[model samples]
Target: MQGTLKDAREVAVKKLSRGLSQGAKVFMNKAMLLSCVQHKNVVNLHGYCTASICQKGGQRMLWTP
Candidate 1:
């Protein structure tokens, strides 16, 4: 899912698979990879979200733009 602020900034939402291991390593990896990435065409990571949604399934997701 995506949403925009009154200022017209674009936002993205990612939904991770359910039953993913509960640990910090996964998040660390994602952050590390994003930091090392350097290219003109590479996607930019905005942030990540981990919480139970009203919809069924999943607790982790990565959002990028």
Candidate 2:
């Protein structure tokens, strides 16, 4: 999924391609990136969710502020 930030809020939603590698790397990468940035130009990262496999048959991650 694709989204744009508004009013100091940021959101990122990832729709994983099927048969992709299952590893902690994806989450780790997002966590690392979110930890480093804190600025007005950068909308704050609020939270995230890992989608159920039955829905899309692949993980979907969503982050918001």
Candidate 3:
């Protein structure tokens, strides 16, 4: 998904797949690695969120935007 931040910066949001056995681990690893990266050629890891929403069949989402 694409969105505009409060500061008017455009960002692309990526939501990791839910319900996979290794989803949490993969999310953490990817977030960590991206956080450490600092290259102009690479898209920045602005932020991430992990949430469990009971309404959506207890959907667990990991979003990086």
TM-scores for all predictions: 0.52, 0.44, 0.63
What TM-score does prediction 1 earn?
Answer: 0.52
| Superposed model 2: Cα runs more than 4 Å off | 1-23, 51-56
Go through the candidates in order and give the clash count of each: 0, 0, 0
CA lDDT, every prediction?
0.61, 0.55, 0.64
Model 3 Cα lDDT, one tens digit per residue, 41-61: 887788766655421443333
Candidate 1 stretches with Cα past 4 Å from truth are 5-8, 20-24, 51-57
Question: What's the C-alpha lDDT at position 31 in model 3?
Answer: 76
Give the distance in Å from residue 15's predicted Cα in candidate 3 to where it truly belongs: 1.5
Candidate 1 local lDDT, 1-63, one digit each (tens): 786544677777655555455354686587568757878897777666554562236456565
Worst 10 residues of 1 by lDDT: 50-59
Model 2 local distance difference test score: 0.55
